[model samples]
Target: MSGPAVRFDAVGLKLGGVEILRDVNLSVAGGAIHCLIGPNGGGKTSLVRCLLGQMPHTGNIEVDWGENRTIGYVPQFLDFDKALPVTVSDFMAMVCQKRRPAFLGLNKSNRRLSDAALDRVGLNGKRKSKLGSLSGGERQRVLFAQALIPSPALLVLDEPMTSMDEVGAAVFVNIIRELAADGV
Candidate 1:
């Protein structure tokens, strides 16, 4: 693999006077999947948040993103959460803005990009589908496509398989592997 797109050196995190991580050093290449498994409360989310420059930490995190690179995040499944009245297109717009804060709104270029992302995730035909109306698999795929629309260099997914059926999980895994392999 090429050099790491994300790197941490002697990284550590402490929150509420409690240590979350310590003496940790790791690197994630541009195109690779590094599964992290441990007992509960092992700071998995904390670590990823730190890497995303979200948490307060005591170390260095270096990101070597290529041109037009950014971070794509596939949030945990929320089918059980409050329903949404908006369409899938609206969610895609939100995801685009999340990736590119400078993006004012859903302009023409952004729409085109989002549409292509939907196509990649097999949700192109469902752009107008209500968020609450989509099946579990479709919803997951929507979020996946949204994250990838901006073509982020690193994709951060936290337990992406949650709330997904076997077929959905399999499809989601394929998408992830493809992204990693394509060096996005």
Candidate 2:
């Protein structure tokens, strides 16, 4: 919490007889903003996956959380059935709800939090809209909002601005700065 949040030591990755990443050494300080920039298929996503434990790699990877550490992740892609009847509010409730079953309905406090998160991402009016009806950019914002619920000590965003408009991107950047300032 007080030092580096993550450290990579001579990290290397390979898949299907191909080298995806090699000799990668980096440190992400706690309460800081770090960006991974590279061309497509350049292993950016792979590195994220490795950090999240979604993929296997070789090397020493360490994550340091001083106390009360939790991780929140927003993935680069989301796949859902087009025919699902989920609403934006319902989706958020599922993500934010802790003790209550989703079908039991969102309590007043949870609803307020969900609404605020949606408003932060410029999706305030879409809370009751059908998830399947949203465009790709809207869906991405929804994902970002979901990640904000029950804030974590470490936030991992993989191509988080994908499909976002200028306004949404600006809001996201501001929120990231605020979170960092709060030592998240």
Top-lDDT candidate index = 2
Off by over 4 Å in 1: 1-4, 78-81, 97-106, 135-137
Off by over 4 Å in 2: 1-4
- Give one digit per residue, the lDDT tens place, for model 2 in 1-184: 3423899998899999899999899988888888999999999999999998888999978998776567788899679996898889889989988789876768999999898989988899998898989887789889989988867788899998888888778988899888888877
* Model 1, span 1-184: residue lDDT tens: 3324778899999999999999789877667787778778998888888887789899898888666557887766754443656788877777666565432446778889988988887778998788888887778788888788767767888777766777777777888778777766
Candidate topping TM-score: 2
RMSD of each: 3.5, 2.0
Flag clash pairs in model 1. none
lDDT of each: 0.77, 0.86
In candidate 1, residue 90 scores what lDDT?
77
